[model samples]
Target: MNILFVADPLEQFKIYKDTTFSMMREAQRRGHEISACEPRDLGWQTGQPVTGQVRDIRLTGNADVWFTETPRRLAPLHGFDAVVMRKDPPFDAEYIYATHLLGQAEREGAAVVNRPASLREHPEKLAVMEFQQFTAPTLVTRDPAAVRAFHAEHRDIILKPLDGMGGMGIFRVREDGLNLGSITETLNKDGAETIMVQRFVPEIAAGDKRILIIAGEPVPFVLARIPQGSEVRGNLAAGGKGVAQPLSPRNREIAEAVGSALAPRGLLLIGLDVIGDYVTEINVTSPTCFQEITEQTGFDVPAMFVDALEAEVARGN
Candidate 1:
């Protein structure tokens, strides 16, 4: 199998814990060929299939320089056995454009995990709304009055930008509402942009759990990212400590329900952010924590992912 990863630059990867690297390693170990290209490398001419300037790469055992690759060459995306989309998000204009290209590649018979159309349909922050039964009292709006009203009712609430990733632009306003107005203005861009606001879930102290669902099945273990010090965000990138644990019953329930619905829509992999019993986010674009869960629990997350990828490609064939 030839697997082409649509991801960020190889130089930007921290091989020790990067999930995309883990996938590449597992695929290579299984004797699958590996290639990589950033979304920017993808191109399509009027008469040509969607293509990329892909670099064929091999993993080196050394940690300092983890991979060796040949020079880039143009290749049609449909030529790969599987094209994995693992680009991190701001989900900006360029990301949307890349998805459009991937969608075209899919039409040309390329096997793309987490289907491009589904990625466009499910914005990480907004996706949770589709499964409101498993979430807290949440609101999405840009009007300051609506935000203030939500704060008045919920007292303790979380405010975050729609496009934030890794805990960026997240704020908590308690009963006193210390910085509610200011935070709202900043997050919503003074009514120019919309944001998500939810009643604060106290169970965050236990951890913000990340449950990985592959091919509509939940991984047995989840990585609980616990906040450090006074931080409210439990994202590992926000200085949180990651601890792997078996999924609680509620966690499994949520994962099963969300997974079943999403998998048929072509999301081969998903990451659900669960705070207590409630899901806080539905991550489709580059859902991670594979290395953390695998290292602590020995569950082999990347292997499960590769198995799913193989199955999908076989079915497509």
Candidate 2:
């Protein structure tokens, strides 16, 4: 089997922590020929799909790491059995363009995971708003007046970029917050990128939950990401600590609902964020937590993910 991973440069990866690295390692272990090319490498030449270069990849050491050898030119989307869109994102125009190219590939009979159309259509935060009944009090707006009103009503609010990943640009404002003006000014500049403002769930002081879903089924383990001292962010990138925990009944319910809703759309793999009982985010763009979950639970989630991909490949055949 041949697999193509559409991702960033190899040198940019932190082998121990990157989920893409793990996925590549697992695929290699299973004897699949793995290759990589950046999204920008995709293009159309004389009405046929083409790419700049593709490199064969392999794991190098005791760690589930990755190293790519020399690159070779290949037909754009025809040779690989599966293409994993594992690029990290701010979901900008380039990301949308890459999805368009991958969607074209899928139409031409290649299996593109997380279906490209769904990836373009579903902005993680906005897509889950359909399940508002299960989420916290949330608002999406760039208007300072509207944000201030929401803060006044909720007394405590969390603000984050509507299109952010890995918990970047997230901020929390208390009941008597003093920096709302400056914060909103900085975020809402540059032609009106709205922010997500939600009523802060005090239960987050305990920890936020990360649930991994594959092929519409919950993976059976959850990580409670506890924030460091005086911090409000629960992202491991933000100094949070990850502890293995079993899913509560409520957590299982939310995961099931979200997984079932998203699976058929080509979002075959997802990491859902739950703070307390409220669903805060649905991470589709290179979602993490696989390493933490596997390390603590010994579940071999990377293998599970490979199984899902292989199934997709079989279906395509």
Give the winner by TM-score.
1
Cα deviation at 24, candidate 2, in Å, is 1.0
Give the RMSD in angstroms, all C-alphas superposed, for model 2.
Answer: 1.6
Estimate every model's Cα lDDT from 0 to 1.
Answer: 0.95, 0.84
The TM-score of candidate 2 is 0.96
What lDDT would candidate 1 get against the real structure? 0.95
Error (Å) of candidate 2 at residue 188 is: 1.0
Error of 2 at 28 (Å): 1.0
Error of 1 at 154 (Å): 0.5
RMSD in Å for all candidates: 0.7, 1.6
Q: Would you estimate the TM-scores of all the predictions?
A: 0.99, 0.96
Q: How close is candidate 1 to the true structure, as a TM-score?
A: 0.99
- Candidate 1, residues 1-317, lDDT tens digits: the string is 99999999999999889999999999999999999999999999999999999999999989988899899999999999999999999989999999999999999999998899999999999999899999999999989999989989999999999887999999999999997899988888889999999999999998999999999999999999999999999999999999999988889999999999999999999999999899999999999999999999989999999999999999999
Candidate 1, pairs of clashing residues: none
Best by lDDT: 1
Ten residues in sequence with the least summed lDDT for candidate 2: 62-71
